[model samples]
Target chain A: MNVYIIGIGLIGGSMSLDIQVTYPEAIIHGIDVSDAHLEEALQRQLIHQKATLQNVENADIVIVTIPVHASIKIIDEVLHTVKDDALVIDAGSTKEQICKSIAAHPKRRNFLAAHPIAGTEFSGPSAAIQRLFEGKTNIICEVEKTAFSLQEKALELFKNLGMRIRYMDPKSHDKHIAYVSHLSHISSFMLGKTVIEKEKNERDIFDLAGSGFASTVRLAKSSPAMWTPIFEQNKTNVIETLDEYISNLQEFKNLMLQDNFEGIYKEMENTNYIKKILKGLE
Target chain B: MNVYIIGIGLIGGSMSLDIQVTYPEAIIHGIDVSDAHLEEALQRQLIHQKATLQNVENADIVIVTIPVHASIKIIDEVLHTVKDDALVIDAGSTKEQICKSIAAHPKRRNFLAAHPIAGTEFSGPSAAIQRLFEGKTNIICEVEKTAFSLQEKALELFKNLGMRIRYMDPKSHDKHIAYVSHLSHISSFMLGKTVIEKEKNERDIFDLAGSGFASTVRLAKSSPAMWTPIFEQNKTNVIETLDEYISNLQEFKNLMLQDNFEGIYKEMENTNYIKKILKGLE
Candidate 1:
């Protein structure tokens, strides 16, 4: 079996590492826009060979792991070129756009839209590590659109990577991810911008940042190249979530202005349900 | 030596654990409004004895660790009653109000306003742990207001806990903390509230939340009992920081509405400097 992975950065590189371990007989081909990423991926042995669009014709499996916008642009082209029986999967954060782009493709049955809900704040091939998807959730959207055999093959691969699979439609997947993933990156990025703009002295941020600040702002370090496209592809949902978030903050601020300590306390106490939800993730 | 810890919760209880290990001969007295907390502290062997306001008279060192509003209300009383040489320190998130409350007290020189930048999201006595202060920053505001000898004694204790000490004025401490510490809490809390409100299915949140979302919203689980007062006490700074954060979000939302992907990308790129700053923390 030959596997072709596009956008050989954090997600792609990590998937390549795990696939190599699980399917030792499989030949891995890497394709990325950056010469440096392809070089790094090859040096790290993430792929057996560096290939391009032409390689998809021979691939038994093709994985698109680029920014969401980029994935939307290139997935159709890959779908038009892959072997008839090949399983084509994408691991982009947003699903609706990419799934919609290939909806009418003749090879739609061969494509699977998945988001392996895993990543650190770091990006690029160097940030890749083994077992990145282990014990994590993998959300597969529009599963009905994919052929049953291909779905089973993808499930086997995900199971081998130690992932639990969940299924949802493309629209629901976009809405849920907007709140759970994209909004978090936006919050952290804005937080970093707000703090950096206000606190002129970097020494003060260094000395004063506690573990809470570190954890809260950790995603601010995420790659703009990756996230901007996600936000762009899922603009409606992202904006909706952002509006809700901004309104919540404004409400809290109004309570603060009014010296409504009890109100503020009640708001936070109500949200403490997140504690129980997060424990399940752990 | 006798050490009196008021409000025996997370910070106070954890401090007791370390102080006992460092000063075995010192008698530890715990005071708190919550009887259950005192009982748990004693059961955990976090304190040598549970005491009352009367214990302040015998205290050679008094540490005020409670809600910021409560700390403000009680520090003057603690200052008036402690031994002339007893070192009094308050580990509240905000510093200006607490420091000012006791500024004119006769025993003011014995009091040190410090904010140890450490803690997990969990709270109460059970949340306390050994070495909670280990290798973390301890910001001692208005150090000049503390007598030289008492400062030396306080330094020794923080050093024994493996904390690096830095100095600042109380006002500056509150302002900086509002951004780095307090603002992070608000962001997390609001993020949690927004997600909870939107994603009605608790199971969806449990299944979909990745480590990035988990870390970003971890502080949302922090005790409202503790944070409400901190926000109230540092109202001006908190409000200021929230305005900036809200403004940043609004600006990003505007860019998203305009499909200004480049603008949003640039914003996140600029704030990527946070990655370098966070490296120093690790």
Candidate 2:
């Protein structure tokens, strides 16, 4: 099988490596707008070759792994260009916009909207690894809209990469992802900005940062180009989640100001339910 | 040398283990308000034996690793009881409160206020590990208030644990830590609350939590008992830093709402300075 992956950054680059490692017989071609990324991907051997969309016409699978805005554009472009039976899947963070973008395409049935819930703060081809998707969940939205053969092909590919699959509506997927994923990036980025602004000496931050701060601010290092569109595409849900996050912080602040130790402890105790949830994730 | 640790929870318990391994001849005694914690400490071999505050009076080194408020109370109870030459240190997150509480003690010069800027989300005696302080910064506040000989003893102890020591004024330590440590905890806890509230099904959170979300929200799993007083003692500083964090989040939210892609991208791009800072840390 031949796989063509668009946007050779972290997610796309990783998928390229994972696929190549899992199935050495599969030819992997990568596409990216950044010449630097393509060069790095080649240096890292993340892809067999650099290929354009037109060159991907013979591919058995075409994965759209671009940023949200570019993902929609590529999905539309592929619908007009790829073979009718080729399995086209998108590995975007949010699903609604991408699904809506290609809703009217004639070859929409060949397209599957999937979000592999896995990544690190690092970006570019150098960050890609062979097992980035192992033990992670891959949520596929509007699966019934995809042709049965294409859906099966996508499922087999994800399963081969050691990922669990789930089905959900595009709208619900967008809402849930905004809370779990997008909000985390926003919070981390803003926290990094806040500390950097107040602690003017960057050296002090480096010397003083313990694992606690490093872990909490880890996602602040994510790619801006990839995330900006995700925040924009899922605006309402992201804003609602951000508002609740701010309100929760404010409530804790008020409790601290009043020296309400019992109140603060109870609030944290309540949120400690996250422990059980996190364990469940493992 | 004999070491007496007043509270055998995460910080204290971990210190006991590290000290035992670092100084094999030292006999460590543990005391805590939580009898259950003391029991666990003994069963885990975190301490050689359980003892009371009276055990501290004759010890070569006495360490108070309790909450800020509780540390103050313990200091008052044992200030006169301890040997004049015994090097006493408190490992509380907030230094100002604990330092002030012991300012007028007749044995004030024996008390050293130190905050080892290291910890995990997990807590209790079971969390103790042998090398928690290795390669970590141990900040000592108001060291001038400590007698020169006692200061040397305390510094030697931390040095033996492979910790690099730095000195700062208690007030400045509290303020700096508010940005580096306290604010990160609030950001993480509130993030956990927001996601849990937004996604009613904990299963969805467990299934969909990517590494980005998991890393960013990891600190939310910290012990409420340990953190509640840290926030309480550093209330003003925490409130100030939290307000800055909220405003930063609001700015990002506005950028998304207005579809200011360039602005959002620039903000996140600028915050990516964290990568350079983190690189320097390693």
Candidate 3:
């Protein structure tokens, strides 16, 4: 079996690692814009060979894992280039527009839009690791659009890699992900921005930062090239989440101003239920 | 040596655990308002015996680990009752008010204000664990205000717990901690509140919440009983930090509205420097 992995970064590079282990007969071809990353993936054994988009015609499966801003055109190009019998998948963080863009294509039945919710603060080939998707949830949008033969191949890969599948519509996926995933990134980035701004005048301000600050600001280290497109694609839902978040923070500040510790206590206690929800998810 | 641990919750109980192992000959007396906590501390072997405020006179060290709202009066009461040579320390999150409250007292020389930057979301006696302070920074405010002999006893305990000391003025400690510590809690709590509020309308919203969301919202699980007083005591600084955080979010929203992806990318890229600051902290 031959697999073409476009954009050999964290997600794609990691997929190559697991694919190699899961299917020993598979020859993985790495395609990336960066020569350094492609060579790095080759040296790290994340892929068997370095290939361009032209080599995708020989692939049994083509996995596109580029930034969301470039995903639609690239995925369209890949679908237009690959064999009709082959399965094509794009693992962009946002699915709504990409799914809509390919909805009327002749090879629509050969495509799958799956987003695996697994990553780290780092990026690129060096950030990839084996078993990154093990026990992670892969949200597959419009699975019914994919041909039965193509769907079976993707399912087999997910099964071998120990990933569970959750079917979601493109619209609902973007909306819900905006609240959970996208909003957190904005909050964290803004937090890091605020603290860094304050630390400028108060040189020793960071010395007082504890594990809490580290945890909340951890996502601020995410790749701008990756997250910028995500926020841009899901702009509406992200703005809605940001509005609610900003208002909630304003309410908290007002409570402090009013000397209403009781109200402040209730606000936090209500949100404490998140602990149980997180525990249940775990 | 006699150690009086007032308020047998996360902070006090954990200190009891370390003190027991560090000073095997010393007896740990748990002094808490909750009878259940006293009994639980006894059952968990976190304390050697249960005692009250009146017994503080026989103490070599008095640790006031209650809420910051109640700390001033309790520390004053403990200081009033304890022997002149005994070191009376209050580990309040905010230090300025607590230090000023006892500045003119006859036993002011016996009082020490320290804030240990170590805790978990869990509270009460059952949440206590040994070596919690190991390698953690203990911000000591007004270290020079305490009598030399009394400060020596507290220093010995810090050394035995494997904690380091950073001597900061009370005002600076409170101001800096407001940004690093208190502001993060508000951000996390507001994020949790925002998502939970959205989940009410969009059920299964949290199903898409990844490790990023969880990491960003983890501090929401912090006890409101512990945090409300912190926000109340450090009201000005907390509000200033909140205003800055909210404005950053607003600015990001405006950037999104204008479709300025470049501006959004720059915002996040600038804050990416937090990674290095946090790394240096570690």
What TM-score is obtained by chain A of candidate 1?
0.97
Q: What is the lDDT of candidate 2?
A: 0.86
Give the per-residue lDDT of model 3 (tens digit) for B93-179: 999999899999999999989999888778899889889888889999888888988789889889998988899998988888988
**Fnat (0 to 1) per candidate:** 0.89, 0.80, 0.82
Runs of candidate 2 with Cα error greater than 4 angstroms are A280-282, B280-282
Off by over 4 Å in 3: A280-282, B201-203, B280-282
lDDT of model 3 at residue B228?
Answer: 88
The sequence of per-residue lDDT tens digits that candidate 1 reaches over residues A48-145 is: 88998987999899999988888877888898898889999999888888888898999999999999999998888899999999999999999999
Off by over 4 Å in 1: none
Ranking by TM-score: 3, 1, 2
Per-residue alpha-carbon lDDT of candidate 2 for residues B158-188, written as tens digits (9 for 90 to 100): 9987888888888988888899889998899
Clashing pairs in 3: none
Candidate 3 lDDT by residue in tens digits, A52-107: 98889899999999999898988888888889889998888899999999999888
Candidate 3: C-alpha lDDT: 0.90
Clashing residue pairs in candidate 2 are: none
DockQ-superior candidate, 2 or 3 = 3
Model 1 per-residue lDDT at A77: 89
**Candidate closest to the true structure, highest DockQ:** 1
For B1-282, candidate 1 gives per-residue lDDT tens digits of 999999888899899999989999989999999899899999999888999977799999999998888887788888888889889999988888888888788888999999999899888889899999999999998898899999999999999999999888888888888999999999999999999888765565558889999999999999998998888888999999999999999999999999998999999999998987788675
Give the Å error, residue A246, model 2. Answer: 1.5
